[model samples]
Target: MTTATAIVAGHGLALRRSLPLPNPPGRPTTVSLSARSLPHARRRTIVPVSPSPRRPCRCRSISSESSTAASAASDTVEEDAEPAETYDEDEDEELDPQAEVCYLDPDADPEAIREWELDFCSRPILDARGKKVWELVVCDATLSLQFTRYFPNNAINSVTLRDALASVPEALGVPLPDRVRFFRSQMQTIITRACGELGLKAVPSRRCVSLLLWLDERYEAVYSRHPGFQAGTRPLLALDNPFPTTLPENLVGDKWAFVQLPFSAVREEVESLERRYAFGAGLDLDLLGFELDDSTLVPGVAVESSRAKPLAAWMNGLEICAMEVDTGRGSLILSAGVSTRYIYSGYEKTPAATQEAEAWEAAKKACGGLHFLAIQENLNSDGCVGFWLLLDLPPPPV
Candidate 1:
């Protein structure tokens, strides 16, 4: 019998059947996104490599004004911008229930999976140690911008965020500063509208599974409207390796232990504990360098509990890393420490992209393989880093 998995929907956590199921095939469309709303929204963004949860290879920027949160939003719209469609808050008609729901089946696999490279930092415009990143957090059916406080001194702006905008060349011929301003405004509006459409809760870690999907679609919509978004060279949306651990054996270990931003001292303490566990388990973990990149898993989002509550209630039980060096590079990085079990760590590091990918295949040979890991080095977009991996593991927990 298949083990039951928990998925967050219908307001809270709901238990559902778990299996490697692909999304039901849908009709092909000439354009990327088929809008359910936002009449003026564009939908021609480039998704170079999207390893969607159910939609193969389909996948998911952050910057700020004073807080990476721009002070003044530009009234200027995209050159091809259509008049904003009015949202009818007073409408009594029922909302579309089946509208663009991003279901993250943790048991599913992705096609065209590749190792996400961390090269954007090297770009003169993107070079940085710890830039402020943010994400949209929904709790109790409301938006939360609590994390904005972390960047009280929001003097610094993210280069990639600005450059990605620059890639568009300009937002409606507006100055770059104005473009950033509008970008923040539009992002907030877009995400707010998205939560209502998808019915996601305003809680920590719960929205992780679906937030990226919405952004990925939004990226295309905005890009299609842009004048010079080329077909090649990175996309606006970034995604974590669809499968973080792939082992032949199906071993569903404990629920995710924790996911949150930690101070350096705390991180070091955790690392020390993790190392002892790995060595004692005889996993003989390799000493890989750690990432200090502060870019969030969902850049530009500010997730926190409601004003009355704090993060302590739900910070644990989630698997996330905010300070890892690679966090800023592409999409989220889901690390499972070095290894969960010595027996599963049988595969040696291999060269050549395709061949090395087989390591995940080797791992799945065991049961409940959710926490398995393959090693990779820090990478630039053009080339793979030293022994760096293009990974495939089980889907991220909802």
Candidate 2:
């Protein structure tokens, strides 16, 4: 048996290296990011690829000013610039605050600190006054920093949430997160407003894997042992995922294909080139505690469109949750941001499409629901407008 070590590099590209199996598969040796160096870790030089001369229509930068005229003019000039260079420049502006804070504390590495995951909802326990107790739980993606506080149900509002969030930096001795992710849709309005007031991007996403795991642990180990704990209470947070909606007419892909890449190829071919828009930092298999063989197949879907840049930008704004084959609807469904869903493509009764979908589902299952989605101008294109490594996690227990 052989295992692979996964590393998330430059702007969330997933990189891996095959290693001789030391421990049993699925039991990964704990590797700390704080370590100065690992004997097994090797550096790979990134050979920059020049932007294609025949560039597709560019998408307006999402981080830029809102004026349409200004955005259009900027997009025209950016068409000739390297996508990676443009992204790096924008990112530096966003990280200036974090960088400044890290300078004051040499021990704190801003790159190693993941976004904060927060949950503010009613708990299964009650206070002495007979009022239901609500709790706020905050934890970083790595689960290294945590803050928990309880309040009466009546006190659950934006003001209370805001004050609690404001204290997180000092309480946990970490810089404010660029974004805060919460899984509950019912609390979206309050959470969004609270984060907005504090200049934090509040994302409604099911990608709060670390926070969910912590909540489950506390439910069984801490909540259940409390005297005020209510027995057999319903789950605190449940999302009513709606049916898949059709993709916007203009954004629909002209061609699509089911694809697969081995772990070795992902590290070699995919990681070598920088992507225009990439989002996979939260889906690291090693951080999520999975160790698989280098030959493991990573199933995915490729979409091609003339408006590849715009399509990629639109998808990047959404918290990409998962992609699945909806056999009943005969369509490929993409789940994103809280309970939002989109029909990626329709297979109908086509034999070839159905078979390909089946193969993709099988391969994805074999790899523990790990897959990706790539947006490119065409199948033969060397560069991708967007690439996302997504995980299809099981629904929360009722």
Candidate 3:
């Protein structure tokens, strides 16, 4: 029997079914921002009092004084022009440190399975050819249900799922509380234990499951319970060997678990991560030598890589030394620690260009923008020092 649940998506936020089962899909919800109202009075300019105009001088006498006053004003102008001390209210704007900004595209057609790459800091598997392979992991609601039923006693009870969701007060409406929270606390334990035995991380369950639900267009009833989990469709595989101790076997089902990943896609994701972190963030890419590059140069993007160029060219362009990785059933993620030498040392290091960049950085900082300032210290060694000049903005008016 399938329990009822609704998938809710919003402009900046998307939520999984808040109500576990037997709940109706409600209206589209929005995260509200409080607005502050300013006072209605108009600002008045302060004028200097003119000493009662020296007993109201006549027009002829005032004309004579005007010439003398003009000379005095000229003398004061030089002193006043010494840079006014104006306050910058914009200096306090803050950066949103949040990782992902998400929204549900209700128009999301489950029938259309969009493909994305999962990155990893390290290889998750080895193919039959003895080649190291990456994995792209995703969050699977069905998988969650599988683990939910697989170990119902230890997992978050279905009743708690319902209550937590129901706790979302009408004022701050969303179908469920943050689904990620559920995964981190309740679902994560079961998944990690299950997949960890198979040497995979559990975070990809969301991305993987969301991908399937969106592409398949199956209803909540299809996934509300855990019984049908054994029949989950197998993902396309290009590897010659089966995953280690992951396949379900009657002899020892508890000893093993399995996750599906596409090898080519994994390679692509790792390559992309390498290029992105290396070029933009100065991430070291040494450990990512295994990932093959698939980038081709477009006209406007000056740095060009040919289809035939070795993948290492991308890494060479940016002096990356290593990467941090997380891998799982259907996902592979790679976080590169970029080399400082490449980040600071672009193709050209002319004096004029350096000065211009410094000035631009200063201006950007003043305007509350991202300032990529260069450190004068030597960056040849591994430990290079750098700092970020970020904007500091006040919280949105409540």
Best by TM-score: 2
Q: Ten-residue segment with the worst summed lDDT in candidate 1? A: 139-148
Q: Report the alpha-carbon TM-score of model 2 versus the true structure.
A: 0.67
Whole-model lDDT values for every prediction: 0.21, 0.58, 0.20
What TM-score number comes out for model 3? 0.19
lDDT (Cα, tens digit) per residue for candidate 1, span 1-398: 11222222111122333222211123121111010110111222222222222421122111111012111112222222221112234331333311222222343222211111011111001113332222221111001100001111243234323333332213222222110101122133333333334332212221222222223333334323233333332322322323333221222111111111111322222234344222111111111111222221111111111210122222222322221112112111333322211111111122321121222222211111111211111111111111111112221111
TM-score ranking from best candidate downward: 2, 1, 3
Residue-pair clashes per prediction, in order, are 54, 0, 51
Single out the weakest 10-residue window by summed lDDT for candidate 2: 31-40
Q: Model 2: which residue pairs collide? A: none
State the lDDT of candidate 3 residue by residue for 26-92, as single tens digits. Answer: 2122111111111112222222222122211101111111111111111211231111112123421
Determine which window of 10 residues in candidate 3 has minimal summed lDDT.
Answer: 251-260
Leading candidate by lDDT: 2
Better of 1 and 2 by lDDT: 2
Please report how far candidate 1 places residue 59 from its true position, in Å: 10
Quote model 1's TM-score. 0.20
